[model samples]
Target chain A: MARVAIQHEDFDLSNEIAELRRHDKRVGAVCSFVGTVRGREEGTHGPPVLSMELEHYPGMTEKAIEAMIDEALHRFDIFGVRIIHRVGLLAPGDQIVLVAVTSAHRGQSYQACEFLMDYLKTQAPFWKKERTPQGEQWVDARVSDDAAAARWGIPGGNG
Target chain B: MKIAVRYFASIREAIGQGGETVETRAETLAALRDELIARGEPHAGALARGKSVRMAIDQVMSDEAAALREGAEVAFFPPVTGG
Candidate 1:
């Protein structure tokens, strides 16, 4: 399996994890994260999000994620990493992203997993536009995501 | 030097095109931006100094101070929101 994928189709978590760990007996721990679309917008009682349209800078998106994985490999003793991000139109409750990591122990896997996610949130070049009862709106970047990435000493200005 | 300028997201929407080739004497990303802004109208409005614009040089995220070379591809857009 490729280390990174950007597709419009929903992914099967079990299948992806299996493909990542296949024949890697040295991997004793696996950590994964899945981000899903929320039905409601925060702080607004407005109508639910009917669908979300994800847009990205194609070549740059893949390159950025690959660089993040390379950084994780340099910082941790992980055995494998897989990241999948979906684009195009998606409905509420649909999965949006997945980051999975494997290592000889849980410590490295867990930290690396979070590190990749935090990095992706701030550094990756992707945008989200939501269709709501209020009409179509582009989602704004969050300061919290920058803070999350800052914990790892990386400056995250995407927010 | 000649360079390729690209726009994305809101900036793309404002500029009405994804990319273009331009002839410029600007030696840095910031200077190139200023050159475009000097063109007036859409370029001025979309790339005004106060606007929150992010840039990438040769497909890698870069700051304004980054040096520009001939035939480099530079992109301007708003801050990214991805997971």
Candidate 2:
């Protein structure tokens, strides 16, 4: 089984790990990735970021992420998975994303963790707008993200 | 039909508005884009050649050929760089 959550508050990694491992005794390893709000908005075509406002289409975001996790489970042999993404006003150093996957071995866990992050990077509908010292600006979407999602052969990543 | 049009980034600044609803008879996204391009210098200039623009209809990524129904929300933005 897998757990996917998109929240506006911070999360406890230890708690999520314990929850994922509670029933799955065969889980021998866990792999995780946390995306933080960086001080600089890389690849943006505008001013530096003072702050960023994140927006997402409510029902669709969760559904898309769940489908992505489902695909990850089908492609990789993993025991459990958990994804936590935060929305709303986020400042630099704030934890914005979390991905965790567990498997009997570290290999599968690592692959699954990477796969989930890649999928979220391109597939998720969230958008970010940064407020720079010069002026407020919206960040441009990256083409590399599309290429990253293409590795999985999923559609709609080209955006 | 009345469709709410939203703009972001340089386009928003160039146009001096965040979003607005517009009445149009265009039945497809392509026609709507053309209509927007013809609006004025700001709209025309912002959407001019070599611009890296992306669009979403009702919050989903959409192409120029995507069908436009009545009252759909359309958004135009520059490329997204968020992770």
Candidate 3:
């Protein structure tokens, strides 16, 4: 299976996990993460988000995520990795991203999964724009995401 | 040298296009950005020094000090908000 995919369509986690672990007898643990669109802004009393538009640099997005997965493989003894990130317009509750990892143990898979996610959040070349009653606005990068990625000792300038 | 300049998100919107090819004498991304800003209008405001802009060279996240190359694909945008 391809290590990374940037699509406009939604993904099925079970299917992806199955593909990642297929024919791999050494795999003893599987860990996955799904990020979905939120309906409301954190501090805004404004109308809830009606929809969101995701934009990404096509070539760069895939390359960046693939590099992150490579880093995960190097840092953690993982067997396989798969990441899918959706683009285009999406509604509230729609799945935005997925990261799945397979390893010989649960601990490694879990750490690798979170590591890929943290790196992707700040490094990947994707941007989100939300539509609300107040009109449309581009989402800003969060400082917390930088802190999250920093825990792994990588600088996340996205903040 | 000629380079491909791409924009995304707010930068793309503000610049009114996705990308373009331009001939430039700049050697670094920062110099390239300053050259674009010298064009006035949207380029000046969108790529102003104080704005939080990020750059990529040949599809890799890069710093302003990164040197430019002929036929390079360069991108300028805001901090990413992806997951």
Candidate 4:
């Protein structure tokens, strides 16, 4: 099974795990990644991250992420996958994103977990702006993120 | 045709509004942008040359030459940095 959601609401980890394992008995390992709002700035002063305003291209964002999830499913021997991404105004320490994958063993689980995150960072069509003491500024996409995606041999792909 | 044009982040601040409907004979995304830039100094300064920006025509990725029709929604924003 494959699950993808672009939500403004928070999700329960245990419930997501349960949903992933509902029908599968051969699953032996479940790997997941949780993205949270951190306090420090990307590269500047460690400002208190009051909040982050996330704006996405709606339909385009969901389609792009769904495609990445499909790629992850194909590249690894995973049995199931789930991705939930939050949008709108989010405060610091709030859960921003989640990626969970399950498979017969740990190797596939770990690899899929890392791969999904790397791809999502570079290929998802979502934008984030941070609120600091100075003002709000748009976050710049990292070149290293592109490099990370390139290491996977997926060519000409960027959000 | 009249279309809703939306701007976000820096572009929004520069234009002082989220969006507005404009009537145009322009037929492509590039032409629409040129129309916006001709609106005044704010549009000209914000969407100036070499800015890292992307366009969406009715919620899909679009290029400068993407065709436009009646009642389309055109959105403009900087390159996404969300994780």
On TM-score, the leading prediction is: 3
Docking model 2 quality class: acceptable
Question: Which number leads on DockQ?
Answer: 3
Model 3 chain A poorest 10 in a row by lDDT: A38-47
Better of 1 and 4 by TM-score: 1
Task: Specify the CAPRI tier of model 3.
Answer: high
Indicate the TM-score of model 1: 0.96
When 1 and 3 are scored with TM-score, the better candidate is: 3
- Model 1, range B1-83, lDDT digits (tens) per residue? 88988898878888899989999999899999999999998999999998888999999999999999999999998888877
Please, what is the whole-model Cα lDDT of each candidate in the order they appear?
A: 0.92, 0.78, 0.94, 0.83
The interface root-mean-square deviation of each model, in the order shown, is 1.2, 3.5, 0.7, 2.9
Q: Which candidate do you rate higher for lDDT, 1 or 2?
A: 1
Which residue runs of candidate 4 sit more than 4 Å off their true CA positions? A42-44, A153-159, B69-71
Better of 3 and 4 by lDDT: 3
- lDDT for A16 (candidate 4): 96
lDDT of 4 by residue, A98-143 (tens): 9999999999999998888888887677778899888787777777
Question: Candidate 4, residues B1-83: lDDT per residue as tens digits?
Answer: 99988887667777888888999999999998888788878888777657766787887667889999999999887766776
Query: In what order do the candidates fall by lDDT, top score first?
Result: 3, 1, 4, 2
- What lDDT is reached at residue B81 by model 2? 45
Instruction: Give the lDDT of residue B74 in candidate 2.
Output: 88
Report how far residue A110 has shifted in candidate 1, in Å. 1.0
In model 1, the runs with Cα more than 4 Å from the true position are none
| Candidate 2 lDDT, B1-83, residue by residue in tens | 99988886567778889888999999887788779888878888877646766677887777778988888988776654434
Worst 10 residues of 1 chain B by lDDT: B5-14
